[model samples]
Target: MKFKTIVVVNDFSFVNGGAGQVAISSAIGLLAKGYRVILFTAVGPVDENLAKQGIEVVCLNQYDILHDPNRMRAIIQGVWNVKAKVVFEKLLRTLNRTETIIHFHAWSKGLSSSLFSVTKKQGFKTVVTLHDFFLYCPNGGFYDYPHNKICTKNPLGLSCIFCNCDARGYIQKIWRCIRQVIQNKMLYQIDGTLFLSISDLSTSIFKKYYPNKKALLFRVNNPVALLPLFERIHVENNNAYLFVARLSLEKGIDLFCEAVSQLGLEGYVLGDGYLLDTYKKKYPMIKFIGWVTGVEKENYIKMAKAFIFPSKWYETFGLSVAEMQSCGIPCIVPDKNAAAEQIIDGETGFIFQIGSLESLKDKIVCMEKMKMEDLARMSQQAFEYSLRENYSMETHLENITKLYDSNF
Candidate 1:
């Protein structure tokens, strides 16, 4: 039960949003429990925050592979890089075989699908956490290409054509298809797969395609770590709604902006994205605060009347929803996907019909009529509900340690 070394592989450094935060939190939790945790990432002049936390970060650039224009070359480097594979192998050889477990978060960006192939061939027990739909979908978001619409088509269907979901055109789609094939093959070698939310509708779609795999399935919803709650300072602002997610089409920000414009209400946006400039020009009244973190993020959550979560795709888990709930902020989310699991309609928060601008507008109008006391009560319920359902780092660490102990 005493694990001396634990290796976590992710796509990016931990200073970025949600996925990186998850990686850092889990690494910190494991380190606290006496594991020598090492993080393997593709590119990093290591994030100072992660370095300060005492976690060792290994970048893949130590390998002699130069960046390539061909997508296949990058994929090959991820799988067959002698230096990166040797670094991992050296760590494994130094540890007791029975006491080491490789926990992989993501391998999409730099580490190719073949990293899992190396781990499995070395006879190392491995676990992968599903962060997005990239494991099966070539686009990673289960969104149709060019149009940016939600795609419900089964990936294994013969009619499954690349939608060019990344907006990079036909060549990109072809490369993504190749990546998908590589990923599916590598997954067969993994010992277990963990989902952050139980409401993984896309994962269910994946199951129908590959029903014979013996991977152990575990759902440990992402933890919400927030600043300490303070006394409610109810600000009387009826027009103050908040949107705190990446400003992308799939996030339904376009619909949200249109709805707000129809309502003639001004709101605040707390993140930036590819659509930021476009939306800013279109809606001059709404405030864009461009990526607030820590105290700034905390205050924004506290000041908002209600947070809007208008995502169209099946999000793995709404990390922003959990963060809002922690700060006693109610959210108006769509009825489908993981948002349905997180929100208690008319109680903790409200649920609008998915992909309907009219329904979203109706919900916003309904919120305008609610008494401040009722909203306050709902906020309290939201905060309490989050504390009950979402795991804390301490609890998650204990659960994962138990899983490793019992399974290994």
Candidate 2:
């Protein structure tokens, strides 16, 4: 079953972050199956790689509204004008109805929520992959601003004030609240919604918020095409620990820094973020290598004794943790969130209590005393687990195809 006129909507045309990369890869996979994919984004400077792969790119002119200084005014203009809806509808009109599927990935940046309504009204089957919490939360990740703490309450609840979660402004929050109300009304209009993680905890959260929606939900894990170069292998002696992710607050980088500083262990940071300058100054002992990609990322993972993931929020999935495990390096993740599902504590790596520096410090101290052979064994277990249960590109494609096929 070939979807000859498939449209993929996202924030960017190129694969940069995890969602961007997933979007590009999914398009490539679809193209390989002889599906004609039209990659749409609000902004472009299309990914050179996607162009090289022969995927068509479409940029919506409505993206400029996001750059406006008065964000609330811009959002008001965006919601009423339905610029994104018009653009998407115009494109859909050109395609044969039977051969098309509108697959939306991310819509927070510039694309207004009205696009979904327009598509549904046109009788087009739509599939929306839940890459993050943007559809339900104003801030996208359901993370509180400044503090970067996770909000557990249902976004639609009456008592749910948007103050802490609103990154734009009070007026913008009002705009978002109005937008979310519209989105909730249009929730059942979608043909399917795909979640990448299968944790029962996450499923329960989704169920609570979207109880009345009849949309089909499927658990399809993201695929890693290449075996990450850092797959755990037996190392005679390993001393450096690695942290590979955006150095953001919700990622618990501050907690990791504090714990490592207290433990006095030698560690390396392989990412860049807003907290870099502050953390660097505060902890002079730890090495910060900024951002890395390709072979450079692999080299860092290969050299690291273990990976540290101390995230305090409910991660939909931990790609870095899986990548590190693939490298044969054990991980020390917080017991909270999806890391608990990813890391087999004591067998593959250790799981410390969430947000507790003392728990993390104790785990680091315990790991520090382990024999090199024992560490290597744990790394082997991590590698075996990732290979057996995760890391398959085929699995992701098959699951996604099932969702698409089932709807048709």
Candidate 3:
């Protein structure tokens, strides 16, 4: 490997979210290939899996932007953390920029944009995975939370700045705008920039507004944990429609609840969030299982007649939908997002109008009307499609290695 030293930078040491999990897994996979790897994080206690693998991890014990105890300090650090800069600079001092690669999976939550400034000054070979829209959009989702629709306004423009699209509030929106300004300035100063987008839509959306045309953009697959099975899982006997994601407005959980309740169908929701309690009370008919993982989550997947992903926002990639598909579960997703790419409409599953309650309900009814043989056939198709995509850890490593080789 030309770039023998890979330092994976993220906000958390553990699998806190999608980006964090990717960061941790990517590092571990790289180490398995015998690359000299280091995991640098801004939040701790470290993930036990990393420690078990004997990977070098540098944890800068700090709170995430939202959870930091001192509100004043959190606000200041969110923009540029002096401590993060100093610590990261120290780490860079020992590395040879020619052979070292600084790959950023996440930062906004804890590490801040200070680390980007180090990359700029040091001129190390760098790559950034567009896991979320935080680098460009102020609130990160590119969706107007107040209006509950996708926001088309260019980020940092007058309309975008004043629209109050942030989930928190307008003031937080202002702070995000400020952070973007600083982050942009730091990014422009660096050269030979590489951005690995999770999906084509994500790359297209990012290219529309991003000022740096010289920045190299490439689409890459995120390695999903589940793999396709040899024999198809029995889907005919499954009783309930499944919704597995955080219970939030952007996730389109309400739409799922509404569609399921309207049709009087059995439904299961297997995740927790701010809206969990509210949704549980509002729709008592739907089973709301809070945050099941491992075998418990797997059992829910096995029991699902069909999986639903009605994301209101422009999700770069839908992880859960792919995971369920790998388990031979047919998935019904909206046509707008990348998850729809995995589904073959009525064959593998169904594709409803994105964010439309009535359209979602219609699809649920259509799926319920599907004959047992058709349902089982679709399950086989879904599993075959997901498995054939080959989004395993080994394939991801091969793709990432190719990406690195091409960049250099």
The best candidate in terms of TM-score: 3
Q: Report the lDDT tens digits of candidate 1 across residue range 149-193.
A: 677777735555634455767776676677677777877755554
In candidate 2, what are the lDDT values of residues 78-189, reduced to their tens digit? 5544666777788888888777888888766666667777777777767776667666765566666555677766675665554646655666667777777777677565
Error of 3 at 240 (Å): 0.7
Residue 142, model 2: Cα distance from true site in angstroms: 3.0
Candidate 2's TM-score: 0.91
How far out, in Å, is residue 350 in model 3?
Answer: 1.0
Candidate 3 residues 269-370, lDDT tens each?
999999998999999999999998877887777778988998998898999888888878888899878788888888999999999999998888888888
Error of 3 at 120 (Å): 1.3
Error of 3 at 78 (Å): 0.6
Query: Could you tell me which residue pairs clash in candidate 1?
Result: none
Q: Which structure is stronger by TM-score: 1 or 2? A: 2
Global lDDT of each model? 0.73, 0.73, 0.88
In candidate 2, where is summed lDDT lowest over 10 consecutive residues?
192-201
